[model samples]
Target: MAQRLLLRRFLASVISRKPPQGRWAPLISRALQTPPHSPGDLTVTSSQARPLYTTRVCSTTFNIQDGPPDFQDRVVNSETPVVVDFHAQWCGPCKILGPRLEKVVAKQHGKVVRAKVDIDDHTDLAIEYEVSAVPTVLAIKNGDVVDKFVGIKDEDPLEAFMKKLIA
Candidate 1:
């Protein structure tokens, strides 16, 4: 209960760009920094009283294969659209396209999933999907291959390709 109140006060003060004035000001001010300050010393400034905690939301938009589970899970099993990245480690183009494709898929913000299938690691999947070349990207939805590109694509075109899938 107290922590919630303190957080609310802190956020409110941060948004308002003013100190949280009241009986709890001293406590809140002390929690904001090391070395407690007296009640009269309570002053909230962006630089002096910023959020001490930080975190990054883990990404679920890339790499979903280490075994024979197949594309059904990431495609048909999932109602959302998925981008299947068919590539091989030795392929020079695959190295460049992987991260670019990931960034494009990530821009969709959970609306899409990027499933990477390494041709060498999962040769069956590659052959089944007719991935004759490395860095062959296929957009799948409801178990159907919808769209694709055979090699590396620049940022704008890649984003457009993903945006079409979500739309």
Candidate 2:
């Protein structure tokens, strides 16, 4: 009788040690039911489609207009010198220059402000500035156009010109 009692107690302990099958079984089954992510199922959001650096430049590029409609307030009125990049989407030279200027602008954010004008969109400003070509970069200081570059130029010269204006 004692042997039988001992066997029953051991069986009870073993059964108790095993989890209630229904409790976790459903959860595990549900977890496994989720389909694995496939390459074809992946979708890239705008924010995630580009790299961090590219996203940064795209965000920092500013748009500005020309003439007396608070142009000075936006650019020249600022404490820092302004570098305006006149460009269009279709211009290859503008495309190359845009990124280079963006890097420079980012590096000199506090000291200088970088602005971009889309000539195609802002034709009045383009005509006022006599922007005959795309990628015309102008350095404005104290409400006056101080230095201008008609084409893609090295960052060193641009930086040097901006430093002089800011100084």
Best by lDDT: 1
> How do the residues 36-69 of candidate 2 rate in per-residue lDDT, one tens digit apiece?
5566554322233222222333344567755546
Q: In angstroms, how far off is 148's CA in candidate 1?
A: 1.2
In candidate 2, stretches whose alpha carbon ends up further than 4 angstroms from where it belongs are 1-60, 65-70
> Model 2 scores what on Cα lDDT?
0.70
lDDT of 1 by residue, 1-167 (tens): 44644564566455455775889888766655534557765444445445546668756455656545646665557788888888877999989988888777777878888888888888888888898888899988877888988988999999889888888
Candidate that scores best on TM-score: 1
Lowest-lDDT window of 10 residues in candidate 1?
41-50
Per-model TM values vs. the true structure: 0.65, 0.59
Clashing pairs in 1: none
lDDT, candidate 1, equals 0.75
How displaced is residue 96 in candidate 1, in Å? Answer: 1.0
